[model samples]
Target: MALRLKSLTLASFLIPSNRNDWDRHLSAKHNRILIVDDHQDICASMRDILDDVGYEVVVTGNANDALEQVDLTPFDVVLLDYQMPDMNGAALLRIIKQKQKAVTAFLITAYAGSTGAQDALNIGATAVLQKPINVVELLGYLADAERA
Candidate 1:
């Protein structure tokens, strides 16, 4: 899939100017989520769904960029693909936890029985979501995360 950029005004998301501003922004109903998947189509589709529902969405195809974004911004939730060429989602979740334990992380995979799925749960993933996720369930998780 080709890489495509979709822009949303930063002001719409209310980019925080300081720590207090960030805290308030996070407490608002409009939360931010990060989608880390190797497939471009998956990222785009997920982003569109979340964006339509009033969440700020950021996506990347690699763990490195995901980690950088995690450091730079506070995400209410992270939807991570379980399989990746560079690193598995479980390992990436560990790194994200180390960086920000407050960020809820979910593993997305077609293979629920895969060791990576078990590892992700063991390493503190909020949940493991099977591929072709139920939009209602996904939104429920996001809502719960936002409330936290």
Candidate 2:
């Protein structure tokens, strides 16, 4: 079965006031995440899941718009879809990495093949996920990223 991230809409959560513990779980400084996919539903779903988890989410449907947004804002992480109409995810990732060497990106796609995964990673994506995405796993990756 494929993973699906269903939770959407951000809400206030009761968190401990302890500075260290809260910082470990989350920061008042929310991480900015950019989602690049041609599918609106996929973009919205990802935004909703990450936003609810205390990330500032931005969504774009095309490579051009994604490039524009990234140029304007600094994103800590980018979620890219492998197949796109104007330009594929690999090409976009190359550009993104060139523009922001420090930004971490993950490629999301239904086509999970050795070649595809390697190509994405070779171009500097932090990881590749097979769709539909599992929210729990994504959070795990984010947690690891926070620690790194």
Q: When superposed on Cα atoms, how far off is each prediction in RMSD?
A: 10.8, 7.2
Among all windows of 10 consecutive residues in model 1, the one with the lowest summed lDDT is 1-10
Off by over 4 Å in 2: 1-24
The candidate that achieves the highest TM-score relative to the unseen native structure: 2
- Inter-residue clash pairs, candidate 2: none
lDDT of 2 by residue, 6-92 (tens): 221122123334657545666556678899999998898888877866888999999999999999998898888989989888889
CA error at residue 42 for candidate 1, angstroms: 0.7
* Model 2 global lDDT (CA atoms, 0 to 1): 0.76
* lDDT for position 49 in model 2: 75
Please provide, for model 1 over 45-139, each residue's C-alpha lDDT reduced to its tens digit, 9 standing for 90 to 100: 99998886678999999999998999898787898998887888999999999888877788899887788888888877877878877666666
